[model samples]
Target: MVDVSAITYDALRVAAEHVLAKVREGEELGTEDIFILYLGTIVNELRDVRSEVARLEDKIDKTSQRIDETNKRIDELAKSLSARIDDTNKRMDETAKSLSARIDETNKRIDETNRRIDEVVKSLSARVDDLAKRIDALQTTLLEIQKLLIELVRSRQ
Candidate 1:
């Protein structure tokens, strides 16, 4: 019997081939062969899931970068506006109406930036939470599969 503990993809493939050869010779598949077949199928599914996780991770990274960039731009704009307000204050002879208008516009921009930031934060948090759950699920599935395979291997021993 093949050592299930030492099983790798290549080894499993060879074992499968051997089992098939036995079948062709009108022999029944061994217990190890049955377990290997089941694991092979699960491995294929896991491969696909792993690829999807990678793709999502990349997307999250890009999105996070964009959010950070946007937040930085908003901060810079707020700083610039504050500077402009200070300059406006220094020139008291300037029209009061114009100063008022500028302050109002700055407030509006600040409010909008804050709103956008909140939205981005919420979106990022939701995405992270979703990813965490998916990762947890994946981990659980992998552990469960490992347990089953280990049990099968141990049973043979």
Candidate 2:
């Protein structure tokens, strides 16, 4: 009878192999040998389960590593995009400042042009007034000469 107590997996495997060899030699297998064979089958199935579990763990580790790498790439892209946006904003601000300065310069030129136009208008108006006064004086002198000529002609008649 095989000692069931304190039987390690290696001892059980050796006993099972011995029993298989005896059975192949046409020797009758006792009940204890059959039981050892059954236990060996259970141990082998457990080993296969452990191997499958390890394989799955390795695959999961690889997937996790890939996920971490992808996250890092996303972070880098975000940083690059943020920097580009900041640069664009800075350029826009500079352009706005330049345009404001140009607008101010244009307004100053417009103000100067208006002042010159006003001066020219005033000068022309003063000259027109002086000419009108001279024309009135000439009309009055002509009327007085006409009256003196009529008086002289009447005295001679």
Candidate 3:
């Protein structure tokens, strides 16, 4: 790499020395030499400014690359999150379906149990009614037998 600072420093030092030497000799500097010397300092300052600008541009480029990398990572994270959400949704749907099927089966079992209970109740009711009718007929027969016994006792006396 070219060392612009070193070159500019050397040029400035040489011009200053030459001017000092001419002044010590009691000689007047030519107008062209003074102009050239003055312009040399200006050119060196411009070179330094250009070097600073290049360094700043390089920093900007690096910063931009870092930002792009960050964006890429963010995009990847978003996609990963989206995929996870979709998977969770699918699992929830499956669970709901399973729960619904189980609920349907439980309802069917409950309905069957209710039907059996009704049938049992109807059979017990019929048995109770039959027992009541048989008891009533037995009571009437006993009353008729008691009347016959009383008539026999009165004739004997």
Candidate 2, residues 1-157: lDDT per residue as tens digits? 8766446876887898899999899998888988988888998898899899999999999999999999999999999999999999999999999999999999999999999999998998998888888888888888888888899899799
Give the higher-TM-score candidate: 1 or 2: 2
| Deviation of model 2 at 149, angstroms | 7.1
Model 2 residue runs over 4 Å out of place are: 1-8, 11-42, 132-157
lDDT of each: 0.89, 0.91, 0.89
State the local distance difference test value for candidate 2.
0.91
* Superior by lDDT: candidate 2 or candidate 3: 2
Q: How does model 2 score by TM-score?
A: 0.63
Model 1 accuracy (lDDT, Cα): 0.89
| Model 3 TM-score relative to the real fold | 0.63
Candidate 3 pairs with clashing backbones: none
- What are the RMSDs of all candidates, in order? 53.5, 5.6, 6.0
Across residues 1-157, which tens digit of lDDT does each residue of candidate 1 receive? 9866456767777876777788789987778878877877787788899899999999999999999999999999999999999998877746787889999999999999999999999999999999999999999999999999999999999
lDDT measured at residue 95 in model 3 versus the true structure, 0 to 100? 100
Pull out the clashing pairs in model 2: none
lDDT of 3 by residue, 51-149 (tens): 999999999999999999999999999999999999999999999999999999999999999999999999988988888788888888888888888
